[model samples]
Target: MTSRPAAPVPATAPAVPAAGRLAAGEQPVLPLSGELELRPWRLDDADAGALLAAGQDPDISHWNLFTVGSRAEARDRIARMHRRRTAGTGAVWAVAPRGGAAIGLAALNDVDPADGSAEVAYWVLPAARGGGIAVLAARRLGRWALDELGLRRLTLRHSTANPASCRVAEKAGYTYEGSLRDALAHADGRHDVHLHTLVAG
Candidate 1:
């Protein structure tokens, strides 16, 4: 495993409350792992903010659908992630490696409890790329969705042009479900996306 640079987060900060726990009668959100803690989003997560900023690099923005164009937008997106969790529609995880700074984010968004499924998306900072952080993070996210959230399946999609993302899905054991041609609309126009799925018992 590639050693990562030390992150700036305080080791003793209070654990953030899980989004599922925000509403009454919902299943309590459990921490997914100590190997890669799946704690709630902290308002004071300076490292997360830094990760978002790092993601705004031109290369990162080239493929990212949702771009944080400014510091204000970055703050707003973080706030919105918190709001979505409270609203019960989504949850975002800071991909923090043990004793390392937060390198990226993985999220279970577009959740549908009635269907027992959700869309999973993830990204790693430039500095954290090629270290298999995305694979580790996606595996943890899939496990938590299945074991803790009682989800039946998780789906992920990325532009067909992004083979790195496809590799991440495959590395994390998601089955290739085929592609949707001209199904995604981007600033440049329409593009194809490869869909992948992971089903759990």
Candidate 2:
């Protein structure tokens, strides 16, 4: 698959806060658009209930951590994300449409500052499927990671059965690195997971 050049980082916005984590309750470090306006997750969004609700949609939550357990567990996880953000661990962004409710979430799940590498994860509402939103979101997040965070590499993983997800990663410029058999065991059984990676030029 062909890769699009990473978007140029804007000079106006500071990459990350001095402490490492993006500043809480401020505008996105790199404003993004298309399909939806991807922005940083706000602690205030917990009250909106979409984060937890995303877990309830089977099509959206299948193979996702939020749906691994139960609805209450998903709610707790969202709360935990907020706490972690304040603790300077990482960020979970809400994929919200302008003047609409949040339909999904994308996050910088892991980060290694010394190596400048991070893993990106995201999900979309069942209602929002088939819109090319996931690919657009992933690309926007990649731009932020490369230009804003100055990351050297970013990776995304999905189950082999999830062809839509694979397409999203490919469209966003991630190379299909390979698959890991029995990588994740669902409640039913283990399944293979496809791993993809993108390195900054």
For model 1, the stretches where C-alpha displacement exceeds 4 angstroms are 1-36, 46-48, 98-100
Candidate 2 achieves a global lDDT of 0.72
Per-residue lDDT for 135 in model 1? Answer: 87
lDDT score, candidate 1:
0.72
Candidate 2 positional error at 123, Å: 0.6
The weakest ten consecutive residues by lDDT in model 2 span 13-22
The digit string of per-residue lDDT tens for model 1 on 1-201 reads 999998888776323334454233533333434555545555555434654665566655666665775556666777888778778788887776554456677888888766777899887777768878788778888977877667778999888988999999999989999999998665577889999999875
Clashing residue pairs in candidate 1, if any?
Answer: 7-101
TM-score of each: 0.77, 0.77
Each prediction's whole-model lDDT (CA): 0.72, 0.72
- Misplaced by over 4 Å in model 2 are 1-30, 67-76
